[model samples]
Target chain A: MPYAIEVTDVKKTFSGKQEVRALDGVSFNVEEGTVFGLLGPNGSGKTTAVRILTTILNADSGSALVLGHDVAKQADLVRSLIGLAGQYAAVDENLTGRENLTMVGRLNHLPKSYVAGRAKELLEQFDLADSGNRTLKTYSGGMRRRLDLAAALVARPTVLFLDEPTTGLDPQSRNDMWEVIESLVGEGTTVLLTTQYLEEADRLANTLSVLDHGRVIAEGTPAQLKSDLGATVLEVGLHDNDDVARTASVLNAIGPHAPNISGRVVEVTVDNGPVDAMEALRSLDQAGITPTTFTLREPSLDDAFLALTGHRTEDGDGEDGSAAKGSGGAGDRAGQPESATVPVGGNR
Target chain B: MTTTISIPTVTGAPLATGVGARVRWAISDTLTVTKRNLIAITRIPEALFFSTVQPIMFVLLFRYVFGGAIHPGHGINYVNYLMPGIFVQTVAFGAIQTSIGLAEDLQKGLIERFRALPMARSAVLAGRTTADLCRNVMVVIVMTGVGFLVGYRPTTGVLPYLAGTGLILLFAYALSWGFALIGLSAPNSETAQVMSFPLLFPLTFASSAFVPLADMPSWLRGFATYQPVSVVVTACRSLMLGGPTSHWVVQAVAWTVGLLIVLPPFAVWRYRTRT
Candidate 1:
């Protein structure tokens, strides 16, 4: 089946006194009816890429196709087939929830009856029935975000682009949004989401692309990216900070690969599993280095991102030594060992 | 109060056929926005109180305080002469609200939502301008009622009175396009207010609104005489106070037509650039 979204060598340069290249020949494809994720840190060109795909911003070069329509040439048709919830909540505060949805439906050229009926259905579906008559200003942050999402889906778009939909929300609200997103994809709505939350991407996206600067550094299923790092990650917390280097050398003798020291904790990836874990512990015992804690488990997406990007996911800065972290899960463990590290964060 | 009960029912089914469907959709959407504005005005008593009461206060101050010193010996009562100019002034003042409204809408990201929709781009502006024109009509009615209570009467016949009122409404509507352009282009509400003041204050004061332009110094008079506000005020006064109406009436109509041609496109261009 043809992909729902295809971006080929797309480049966008925002021109001013100082020109910023927002997208540098970025390319990717999202299969139809799949939850695709553009995973990156802040200012990693995720929003710019979504803007280009939505046909809101014209690319300086390259091409993007959505739902078999060229984004540049057939922008209107592309827009009609997709729903977009921008980074910020864009609902009109002066309007009631019902009015906001109806207005968007009317703008989409739906029949007035269909607009009203669809608005009613959406209001109930989004748990906004009781507050449908209230002006949006009176709504809580979560309600407004939900209403914004409902307005985007009023046209029943086949492709939905959500840019950081859950940012700044409380934990409960974020979970609620995740549920709504899951149900949307359950009904076969193809979704492309950009987020800073590693868990959000790991929970929602079937296929994830780790974007840095303006290019895709790694792409695979969550488990595939993680297991590709090896069988298990032995994370050992040290009792003394001075024991980290000594512990690393001891684990290296058993595991072949050197252990990575993060503060008081030492971590090593090994394929031999518990046998390797026993051998490393015996070596440490013989060296008289008593550790604080030790755990051997499957690697996480954070580990995969660190192995690929050489940086943690949670680290705000994408420069040297900041491996993106958080969202530890093991789902599909397939490996693609092509290590190419581009510039961490360009203007785009 | 008569309490009449009617069953609530939904009307107007959505139809998917027609090339002009988006235009109709835009008109309806615009009406919804207008209704929301009206509801907001009603809910906030201060908005209605100020809109209705402010012009009446201006009429009272000018007719009682400045009436004697600035009288032109054109055989017309100063209040009668001032009534028409007040109508233009109130309507022009009323147009500023559109700018403030647009600026607020932009700040709230409502305009961005409209842009992303499949609706016609021109429809948003068209709907807003139409709603504002209706608001101008309401202000004209209220000001006309207050003018009568203050001993100001239109000496001209009903046709000329209607024509003059129409002229004021058209001029105000056209002026609103310029204000809407400012609202769309300005970076924020404070900048929009600052940007609007230079044009707004000069246009109101330099014209024949509060005083006769002939009484001004030669250079000032030359500038004030051809001002669009002056042409509109002169024509409206001619029709209301029974004067030679031929020349000023033509000038007022020409100014209105010219503005209608110029400002809408300029507003659209500015909107396109900003978005």
Candidate 2:
């Protein structure tokens, strides 16, 4: 099998007071021993896709397969091949750390002798060996998450699904989770990760599908997506808010794409960094718009995502604003600093 | 904390084929899940403590406070009459734990994790009901001890007493299936408790669990006389005290058997279709 997981035009509509199209003809394939990220904001169908692929949910139309087994028809066969660590830590709070892992191991029907030793190994590996005897209620949030991940690994599933694994964790815990996921990839495990974090996808995913409102907006390698945004993100912070339009128009002539103006800041992705920086400064000066700050930097995934989706990843669906709108009127002040932090990498 | 340990790829769950193998696999998975619940109860000693303590409180409240005013008829001692009623009420109430536990699991996303595993789908429901059944047994035994402590005696021999206990446990087990369905449907554990309590309150209170059918208003008497809980309580009373072998035993068995047949299939289906 070339692909460890295959989802083909899967669609699901959740019927309630208002029908939600959780997955709208979504499709993606995950190759063996590589991380495939489904990047989306909340309610963007990242979790819905994971649930269908894990056999916890059935797609209303179309199909999904895990290691060549149909997720709907051959559900048990597919289930045996994949492990899922969901957004919530699913470990029993009343059970000890070791107990939770052992219970999952037994449910997976591993041999009794193997389960005990495997649970011990996993507890130690996840840095919970000393606290293995303590109930999960006594464990910290990060500890619980680590144990949840360890429980998912109990049966050593070939394909793993992590739905927003590091979502609410502290930075240290998130980094630790990243290392664990990286090591799993090193050991030849295929991972399908759903994350809202742009940096996580940029650092981990070999290839990613950027989803917005149940549709794949863009799909590519991080570098490919970044380059597609252009070689440079030219951010010019004007001294006067009145000069926003002039700064954007001047930069428009410098780059192929239009500048995204937020408050006094005008940002545009350009084909060349140093040359564009020099041209932007000279043209802005000619236009009588003296920039308070001029930053010429390589485009990060954040810029790529913004360019593709017309909105930031962290913006909730209801709060989502189009790129053309940028920041206007009363919302401009708050959105100024927010947009300034977007190009966090290669700022010079 | 950033220690990198090698992950060894081990074999996955063994697939069960054929009816016999499937049944075995399901039974094993059920036991495993049941053990997890049981261990949880043991870890939180307050759960077992409160479970036993609640029934004892009910026994004392009825025996001392309500016992003086109420009469169950036939020259029977109030304690004996209340003992059988209390057992029925306790187990019926005990079954609510099924709904609460399952709802907690659902809210916590443990049910999603279980569903994703290769384990049998029925195991989660079966295991939950089974654990609740175990809890009902312990509560019954403790209530029996409290019954004896309060000067209640079973006139019939050990065999009939055992039969009465078996009948009560079976009825509660059947009810657990109904509660399991509620748990799966409820949005959270608190809602599950809220949903099951109203459904159970009338069944236990309106029936002959505490007061005799004749004591109730004329309209309620009809329901109080023949409802499953009243039938079971009456049957238990007859078994514990050597009475005219009325058809209450047959009726109670029939009601419980009917519930066992109907409710489990619904609960299993709910478990399967829930997302």
Candidate 3:
């Protein structure tokens, strides 16, 4: 099947006193009806790529095709085929939720009667029917985010571009958004989602791309990328700090080379986590380096991100933290790895 | 041999769309957006009060306080004379609301939402301009009512009165376009207000909205006489008060058309550049 979205050698540069290359020769394809995630850190050009694809910001160079129309030359056609829930709550605060949705429907060239019906359906679907008459300013952050999403879907666009849709919502709201996104894809709406959250990509995306510094460093199915890295990580922490190095050396002996130590924690990647854990424990006992705690589990998307970016996903001089905060907790929600407590490195 | 039934399927031809259809689409979208703006005016009554009521109050204050001190040889009542000037002044003052609304919309990310939509890129400015024109009409109505109450009568027939009103509306719409441009280009709402200051004083004071241009010093009179607002207000006054209206009417229409042609594209350009 033809791709729903195709971007070829896209490059965008913001020129001023200080020139910034927002996107540099970025290229990717999102299959039709698939949930595609563009994952990146703050200032990683994910939003820029999304913006260019959405026809809001023209790419300085490159060809982007959405629904068989060129984005730069046929922007209006591209816009009509796609719906975008921008990074910010771009809904009009002065207007009621129903009005916002209806406005979008009308903009999509739906007849007045159809617009009314679509707005009603969307309001009900998004669970905003109860407060549809209330202005957006009175709604909570989560409600606003949901309404923004609903507004984007008012036209029932074939290709939906959600740029950090659930950024600042509480966990419950994020889960609700996730469910909505899942259902959207189930109904055959191709989604191009950009987010800083790793789990979001893992859970929602059929295919995911890890971007850093305006380049896609990794792209695959979540399972494929995780398994490609080879071995699940088993994280072992000792109650005593002095035993960390000893524990690492013990695990290193068992794995022959994969154990790494950070402070009181020792991490080792193993093909068979449970069997390796048993052998490593036996070795630690002989060495008298008893670890207070150890757990083995599958590698997380964060681990994948770290492996690709060569740094902790959250360590970026507060820039990423602020960007995440600015986007409203969507990044942090996705940042929370589901297998968080899994011991690092027993699976080979 | 089995006979097969073959159904000929007919696909529809592409619709014969034109620029008119696109413009209509843009206008409809603009109206939809402006519906909320109109509702917002009611929610924030202060905007209406300031834009409409305060200007009328200023007219009353100026007429009673400063009217008798200044005179022209036409033997016209100060209030009657000031009505035309006040009409222009009120409409010009009312143009400030366009900037304020634009700034607020920009600050709130409303324009960004419109930008992402498939509607005409010019629809946002069009909607704003249309909405402000509606507000201008409302203000004009109230001003006219007050003028009637204060014994200011237009001796002309209904057609000329309507023509005079149309001229002011056109002039105000054009003037508001310039303000909208400033609002769209400003980095923030506060800065927009600051940026509009240079246009504000010169456009209002240099016009024949208050004192006659002939009463001013020679150099100042020359400038004021040629200012667009002066031409428009003089045209309005001539039509309403039964004076030679031809020269001023032509000048006023020309100025209105010229500004309308120039400013909207500039506003759209600024909007595109900023976004």
Candidate 4:
């Protein structure tokens, strides 16, 4: 299959009060007509990668090509072939939804005669027909996101770059966004999606690259990553918080990998489901650490993410990391305003 | 909103090459953005209202409050002198909208979106300054009506009055380019506003926009008389009130030409290197 996008050894560093190596020799290839997910914690250089591919920021070294056009040397050609929807909606709040779409269509250099009809069709497709004439200030967050996505589709771009597209969306809106992406893929458009949610990657991405500290640590299908992790996760919920370390030490012998802890719960991915479960319980009892709860379940991408990155995808305290929303997630910082500057690296 | 959206034909043709297509694309993109900004003004009419209202207040303030306090040696009415000054002042202040608008777009990530598009890079700044110029035209018209209400009459006929209006707008357009640089350099809309005012207050007040230059202190006279704002105001005064058209108009045109030559390329460079 021909590649829709190729990024090779792309590196970019932003120098200021402190230097941030936003993309440290990142390389990835996205096949035509497939969703390629870049999964990483916030500030791990996902936005930097997208900015490079979209031709918004030039890499310090290395090269990127979109649809065979060099992003650096032939940026205009690359820009004409790809569309980007950033972490923020990026649509004009003062203009009506219809006007914003038409504006983008014109900027994309679509035929003047074709733009109005195209904007109308996109508004209907995005279910924004009713509020198309109303200014975007009145639209809900979900509606604005839909319009933003629609605006990106104005010229029917062959490749679309979505940088944390569903980062702040509620569950229903996220699902709707996923459906829109799925439908676009069904029409044979290539997509490069950057997201923090493992489930979003699992559901949409045909292949995923897990990034950490501005490097791709693992790349595979969701099932491949999960299966490579282990067969089951031995989760031991300890009643006493102090006993957690002891439990991890006790369960450490069962799995080849080290035990992972969150609060009082200790989890380890084990190859043998029943044997490890039995071994974990007996070892805990012998150590005089009474388990508050215990369960041995199939490993999920969430477990795989934790195992590979050595940190949970969502805020560590959340019960289910996948369900957690917003910029309050583990490495996501809220105080600084988002700017054209490389996403800051202060989260570390 | 139209209820029924037709199934539109999709086209993904390659971009045309050569100079003509490029220029056409830039012009088309500029007009599109200008239309978007104009629509925004319509949605928030209060923005337009406040922009004009400030000039109107200045008209009332200088005419009623400060007019009686100062006398012109040339036997010109205070309202007549103040009207041309107000015209220059209003357009000069109106140019700040270019700065604030671009900064607001930058803050909201809209500028990033524009950068990613296939269109001409100059269109964003060109569109902004053009839209602000259009707004300045409206403000000039409204101020003219207000001037008439206060008994200010132009001694020149229709063509010269139009020429004076054109010169004021040309100066404003040139100033808008300078503000465009500030907008692109600023981190946000609020910063753009804060940064622009220090530059504006000094130019507008230090020039001959209000009182005559002779009444000012000797040290301030040279700077006040020759500054671009003062020259443009003097040019407008000559064109509207029947005076020697050559000297002041020539200087004002030269100042506009000089700014047009210097500021645009710098603003474009700022826009290009923003990332």
Candidate 5:
């Protein structure tokens, strides 16, 4: 398959009171008709990279191509083929959902004859037809997001850029968003997804690049990244944040690798999943340190993410970190990376 | 709200990619975007309400309250003199909204959505100034209606009055581009408003908008008379009252053209390079 988007050694440094190298020689390729995930914890330059690829933010050096057109030189050509749903919905709160989507079509110079029909069709597809006439402020978070996604499809763009599509959504909404994204992929639209959630990337992306400090730490298919992590995860969930360190020490006795504590859970990479999990829990039970829940699952992108960022997948947020969703199976790990700003948030 | 959408029978052919096609797209795209801004004004009733109310309030307060005390000349009819100046000032005041609107769009990341599209980069600015022009026209008409209610009459014929309205709109349109730079440069909507006020406040107050420049101190008179705001006010006053009409009209036109020439590139440059 042909590549729809490609970036080579892209660099963008923002100057303020201090200089922030938002992207330092970042490179990636998104094949056509496939979802490519740019995974990062926070401020990892994923959003910046998406901005550059979308031609909203120019790179300090290096070139980006969308559908074979150079982003900086042939920006209009690239823009015509791609649609962007930003970190924020970017819809006018005063305008109704139908108006918002139609405006996007108008901006693209889509035929006035077909634009309104397309907006309605998209609203219906996104399950927002009944609410299409309501102002965005009146819509729920999920409804607004559905409208934003619908607006991006106003012109039926060949390539789509979705930046953290499910950041603030509840699980049901997030799953609905995932289903919507999956359906779009079925229609052969290439997607460049930037997200902080490991499960979101695993569930939707065909391949993903893990970014840290403005560089790609690793890149592979979901299974490849997990297997490449080369470890089995012992996830121990406890009652509260206070129980993390105590649980970590208990898991350390059975696992060969150091236990990584993110908020309330202690994750350890062990030699054998079945034998080590039982031994660790037994030790914990004897010590009277009963885990609220424990599961032995295959390594997930979260473990790889932790390995790359060198921080617990705790999202660095003190409040919701303890409540991070638990991923019981190897296929899906529930960790939503909070919206992280680069130590210096710039160009956004 | 649920009207049936017309099925498009005309799915037009793709035009050949050339300079002519690009130019055509620019025009159509700009009008489309302008339509969006104009439609938004209707939906946000408060924005329209406040925009019209401020100028009417100024007309009422100045006509009834300040009219007896402020004299332009013995027979000049302070309401007539004041109405033209008010029209000019109101149009200029319209620039602040341009900046505030653009600033809000940028702050909310709406401009990024615009920039990401294949549309002309200049469309956003063009649509905004065009919308402001439309708004200034309505405000001027409402203000003129209010002027009549308060006994302000223009002695000039229909042609001169039309010319006066055109000049004020042109000047306001140019001023909107200048304010657009302030809007694009501002970090947020509140900052955009605060930043524009200090700059525009002096232009309106220190000029011949509300009172005669002759009453001002000599030190302030030079700026009050020579400034663009003053020149437009002077041109508009002459057009409305059939007063001396030597170079003020030409000078006002020149000032507007000068603003148009200088400010657009700066605003476009800022929009293109803001990141």
Candidate 6:
């Protein structure tokens, strides 16, 4: 299939007293009708990349094309083909929900006769029909977001760019947005979503690109990325510091990978975490090493991110990825404030 | 959700193709957005109330309190002499709201929202200036009624009276573009309001909007004489009070045209360059 959107080594730098490189040679392509997820944290160029692709911003070098039209040279054509819901809700506060949607419809060149009707249809679809006549200031945050998304869909765009659409939404609202997006794609709209939440990307994105410091560091399906990191992690904690080396050797021999240690804790990634945990404990038992804790865990997207970027998913700072780096014992202590000996990575 | 209506499942937006059709669509887009803005003005009772009342306040304050002391002399009634200056000044101050509204839109992402649509990009600016123009027209009417109530009369008849009002609106419309640029440049509402006052203070005060050119210091009078607001006020006075209208009309029209030529392109350029 021909690519619906193609970005080729796009570079964008914001020049000022401090020349911040907002995008550094980033590239990706979205297949005609698939969801492409761009995952990154704050200051990681996700917004910059979306701006360039949506033609809200221009890249300093390289090329970006939407539906075969160059974004820089043919911006009008690109604008006609796509819809964008920005990080913030972009509806006019002074206009009523229906008025805002109708105004956007007319702005997009929809027939004057059809605009009001179309606005009504979209409002009902978003479950905002009852509040259609109310001004946006009176709407709750979720209703405003829903209305903003509805406004973007007025033209029935072929490709949609949602830049962190659910960032600040409550759980139910986020799920509603997710379902709306899923329905859009189900009806043949290609979507490119940028997000900081790992669960959002895991649940919604068909393919994922992990970005750090304005560049793509990793790209694959969520399962593929997690599998490449390893199947699961086996965690062990010894009661005494003296038994740490023995526990590490036993775990290192049991798992297919080397054990990573901090203080009296040890952890290793293996193909089967439960089996590996049982083997390591048996070996340690024969070696006369008593561990205070042992457990297995199903690897999460956080684990994939941690393994690939060498940073915990919670630590947004890429330059200091190790700021919140914790050992198996640290994870145990952190997980339960009430007790220190509870097994970390508690899978079963 | 109820599906009692025909929901547009999947389709492309209709483009305004062909040269004539596109030009017509552009005008339509401008008018639609303008109507939206005008509706906002009516809905916000405080905005409408303050806008109408401030000019009334100015007429009363200057008419009752400051009229006798600042007369232009030569047997003209103080109220008649003060009406044109007050009316023109109302439009100028009324134009400031354009910048505040535009800046608020920019801060709230409405400008970015407009940028993404397929409409003619110039329509945003056109709609904004036109809505503000309509608001100024209403202000002119309200203040003129207030002017009549306070015993200000123009012997110059209806033609020039309408012309004087039209000229004030024209100048205010062009000046709106300048404020549009300021609005685009201002990052927030507070800055948008305070930042514009410094630029406007000199334009309105230094010009003969509320006083005569002859009452100024000689050095200040040079600018107070030929500045756009002064030229416009002079044109207005010539039209309504019946004097030599030729030279002032020429300069006033020239100033309005010059502003029209310069500010819109610059404002649109600034709008385009935003990231």
Compute fnat per model.
0.35, 0.84, 0.43, 0.64, 0.53, 0.72
| lDDT of each residue in A105-197, candidate 4, tens digit only | 888877767889989999999999999999999999999999999999898888999988898899999999999999999999999999987
RMSD of each: 8.2, 6.9, 7.0, 6.7, 7.6, 8.1
Rank by TM-score (best first): 2, 4, 5, 6, 3, 1
lDDT of each candidate versus the true structure: 0.77, 0.84, 0.77, 0.84, 0.80, 0.80
Model 6, which residues run further than 4 Å from truth?
A230-304, A312-348, B1-10
- Residue-wise lDDT of candidate 6 within A248-274, one digit each (tens)? 888778746677787878877788766
**Candidate 1 segments whose C-alpha is farther than 4 A from its true place:** A228-348, B1-45, B52-57
TM-score against truth, every candidate: 0.82, 0.91, 0.83, 0.90, 0.87, 0.86
Docking class for model 1 is: acceptable
Positional deviation of A151 in candidate 4, in angstroms?
0.8
- Interface RMSD for candidate number 6? 4.8
lDDT by residue for model 3 (A1-348), tens: 889999998997666444555666888899999999988776667877877787777888889999788998977767777788865778888789998888887876777887798788988998999999998879998899889898888777889999888787789999999999999888889999988777788789988877765667777776666665546788888889878777777778775446667778888767677888888778888888767778887766556656555555555423332232133121232343322212112243
Kindly give the number of clashing pairs for every candidate. 19, 0, 22, 0, 1, 0
- lDDT by residue (B43-62, candidate 4, tens digit) is 88999999999999999999
Interface RMSD in Å per candidate, to 1 decimal? 7.5, 4.8, 6.3, 4.1, 5.5, 4.8
lDDT of 3 at B193: 80
Model 5 error, position A101 (Å)? 2.4
In model 3, the Cα lDDT at residue A20 comes to 55
Task: State in Å the error of residue B133, model 2.
Answer: 1.0
Model 2 / residue A84 / CA error / Å? 0.7
lDDT of 5 by residue, A156-274 (tens): 78899998899889999999999999999998899999888777887999988887656776777876665545448888999977677778888887745778876788888776778
C-alpha displacement of B165 in model 3, angstroms? 1.9
User: Model 4 has how many clashing residue pairs?
Assistant: 0
Cα deviation in Å at residue B94, candidate 4?
1.1
lDDT of 3: 0.77
DockQ order, best first, reads 2, 4, 6, 5, 3, 1
